[model samples]
Target: MNPSITGFDYQRVTVAEDVALNVAVGGSGSPIVLLHGFPQTHLMWRHVAADLAADHTVICPDLRGYGASDKPAGTVPDAYAKRTMAADIVALARELGHDRFALAGHDRGALVAIRAGLDHPGAVTHLASLDVLPTLDMWDVLHGVTAAVGFHLFLMAQPPGLPEELIGAAPDAFFGHFLDIWTRDPEAIPAEVRAAYLRACREAVPSIVADYRASAGVDVAHDRADRAAGNQLRMPVTVLQQDWGAALGFDAAGIWRAWAPDLEHRTVSCGHFMAEEAPAETVKALRDLLAR
Candidate 1:
């Protein structure tokens, strides 16, 4: 039930001793790694990856704990930290013979891309982030009543047992909720692809929760350290968001500016799932960022 992204060859590459990533690679020329977000697989980038593959070598991988990737159920909160996830991406690209490449991430993947750009400046030529704020800013923005929009964040942030138990109780309903609400058009994601996402998520519950759990714990600590050290993305960065700041009363661009000195922050008129909801615009934004 993979997305209808033809012409790409899939492979399982070991990025770490205990972890391997399921990757989809296509096309030629300079490489660009595309990372998918929550409740979805690399299939989420079918369209954008396909388009980018026409010119660049598009490397799309299911971030470590999601999709068909290796999901080690470690109790440590740092298990799924962006730093670890970001290292996974870098290792995957290097395994595929890409020492340096342009990187774009959507949702949770965007968080990873931000970390990659910051942590591996010389290795990432360009960086693009869609529909997400940095980890520290994300937690800060979710303070008080505005946090209601991301109840899943709070739920997943809790200690292991309950969240996993509750989500696993009705895996389809839990994952489908985000898929249904996050997209602007219900029909944007084909029913079969939706089914695939649900199936994968259902099978990867523990790994998935661990991924979110790391955000509240280790991810925040890493962000705070980076912030204190004044470590911003050294590459040209482009951030495309749904203008949540307007509704939530936080300055999205201003927040991102603190983490990325050379940044182009713009708002997209789409839902949280920008790549699927607005592929053309998403592709254009990535192209602009790559050219930088």
Candidate 2:
């Protein structure tokens, strides 16, 4: 049996013509969709979801091509594009009876949330992102030695064959590497939870690689177009990050301000997986965002 969010009702919500997302939904009164990051699943939001469920209907879904969700082969060129994935989330929420909802995402999930806010501004009431810059800003800022921290992005960005084969060869070490290094406190991710993440990622190697590959290609193009058109997130936005901008030599909040006019950006002391390592703070930040 796989690990899941306790007390949450689980179901498969068909979000596309062929893709149905495995979703865990709980609580009532208004909806807030939570999207998980790479190398993990909706279970990553177990702590925060439960806390938020007290007042808000919490919807956590394993994004398409991840976890228990359907992973249609990336036969279409834009199959794994953030725009497409964002549409999946929108459709999922509507299927679950939400026409509008607040949105929050971490890491890769944050990227998808950004796309959703831009593409469907009418649907997202508020937005929050944890630990990631927009795709275009991400590519622009990562250069020379600083880019080494995101080597996997470059590796997975390769043209299809080698990246998939190499990563598939030793999926655990490849997937577990982030699980080990990116986490500040090991205990934040319990043994069982870590194992589940590794298992899910191991099985979804090709699709996972395609996801990152799209970030490097189509995702960037989408963000670039949005920037050119001066498209910005109209909804109120909150961003929580680990002060990577200080080390990486960029103004994190400044960059975010360009895309989100009504923005609240704060730097946290915790690691990349802040929701697990610092759920209380994460929850408080979320609650505050909701109040606004």
Reference-based TM-score of each model: 0.98, 0.99
Top-scoring candidate (lDDT): 2
Question: How do the residues 13-124 of candidate 2 rate in per-residue lDDT, one tens digit apiece?
Answer: 8999888999999999889999999788999999999999998999999999999999989766689999999999999999998999999999989999999999999999
Considering summed lDDT, which 10 consecutive residues are worst modelled in model 1?
1-10
- TM-score of model 2 (CA atoms): 0.99
lDDT of each: 0.90, 0.93
Q: Predict model 2's lDDT versus the native.
A: 0.93
Error of 1 at 119 (Å): 1.2
Q: Give me the displacement of residue 203 in model 1, in angstroms.
A: 0.5
Please, what are the lDDT tens digits per residue for candidate 1 over residues 159-248?
879999999999999999999888889888898999999999999999899988898989899899999998889899999998789999
How badly does each model clash, as a count of residue pairs?
0, 0
